[model samples]
Target: MARSVDTRGARPAACGLQGLPGAWRAPFLECAMTLAAPEPATPMSAGLFADEAGCPRCSWCQATPLYRHYHDHEWGFPVVDDRRLFEKLCLEGFQAGLSWLTILNRREGFRAAFARFDAEAIAAFDAQDVERLVQDAAIVRHRGKIESTIHNARRVLALRREFGSLAHYV
Candidate 1:
């Protein structure tokens, strides 16, 4: 039998194999088990957990500042504006193989590299501009996404001309 340390009874006695007295057994055992067990992860994304009021803890969002900000501030929000919708479509497409945090962090660079995501401006870009964008390090340099952005911009422009606005068209 292992004897437990006693410091004027302030410290709880260990619940040995037979367990401590009923008064102390359950609570002491619980505390000991709790201390040894991993704490449950608290949710952080409010939109993900309705019962938690949107602050659902997500394993992917562990501790990165950019990820936390995007998760809390931007995820799941709908867009109705043509320009904004176009921008998000391009961004989400660009984010397909990469992490959203990477895209979020480089968003400003993307805006700069893509001419602020302006539909007309991007639509005006030629092969020369495509080459320039490929050389730019600020944004993701993937050729497919880069070319797709141009194609999408043209699509948006056509939609705008036809429907008076992409919002109404969509």
Candidate 2:
């Protein structure tokens, strides 16, 4: 039988995983390896798990800097902006079947391609726009996802008008 490590016994420091007990190490490594499995979207951004600044963060983000910034700046924070809320909604949809980190890496690409996720602009997208998006290398190339973005954009228009903002509607 495999033995379990006592997390309480060690002081987690630096890369948080390094401080885990021996038994915990293998399981943690296994989990990390699973997360590293190849997917349609691979994260290009990486970050530190621990630094001198004393910011407590989830050790998982330490695997990549991109995740670190997201964890520190965006994760668990309340978002109030209407457009930003809409953007998050769309991004979450794009995340379906794709690694969240991969979506994180390509967020900029998505923003640029989709007019920074302006629902009004995206609502105007037509078949040609989808064709253009499917061929774009910076963002996910799935045809259904591209079309879904446009469809959702149109739906969001009514929600925005009714709720006064995407933040409120959501």
Candidate 3:
């Protein structure tokens, strides 16, 4: 289903300062503050192109290119496959308390650490893997998040087996 972009109620005309009473005008302008005008809606099929400024906002990417790429290319679009969904979820977990840039700078390390984010491979990660990851300088070395990633990978795999795809679960 195609979603409508609602422009209604999003803009207010500027008050003509010359004609308004000073008291009424300052209050009006202050209250009338609004979001910057939205760009024309893009086609839905453009994949993640809808929010390409990458500022759709995920708590972590405050002001960085990595955050931009992730938001523009990965966040919030529908996912219909299991492995890909699991990968994103795993990354989101890693981003739980840290800035998105921290994880993003280590994204390549993350991929390598989690074996390209393959569900089966990640699910197989054990204490040894966790230990190796702790020693790795590429990714954030948080033990709890690391453990949770593996646990979540297994859960996603189970969901895929039962539902045929994680996207369907969503």
Which model is ahead, 1 or 3, in terms of TM-score?
1
How much lDDT does each candidate structure score? 0.65, 0.68, 0.63
lDDT of 3: 0.63
Could you give me the TM-score of model 1 versus the true structure?
0.64
User: What's the distance in Å from true for residue 165, model 3?
Assistant: 1.5
Residue 66 error, candidate 3, Å: 2.8
Span of 10 residues, lowest total lDDT, candidate 3: 10-19
- Cα shift from native, residue 22, model 3 (Å): 57
Best by lDDT: 2
The window of 10 residues in a row where model 1 has the poorest summed lDDT is 1-10
| TM accuracy, model 2 | 0.69
My TM-score estimates for the predictions, one after another, are: 0.64, 0.69, 0.61
| Winner of 2 and 3 under lDDT | 2
lDDT of 1 by residue, 1-170 (tens): 11122112121123222223333233323222111212444332333322122223234555586765554334443456676778888999999889887788889999998888899999999999999999989899998899999999999999999999987988
lDDT of 3 by residue, 1-170 (tens): 32223322311233211212332222322333232334553433323222333212333434576665565344544454565667778888889878767777888899988999898898898999999998889988999889999898888889889988787888
| Rank ordering of all candidates by TM-score, starting from the highest | 2, 1, 3
lDDT of 3 at 167: 77
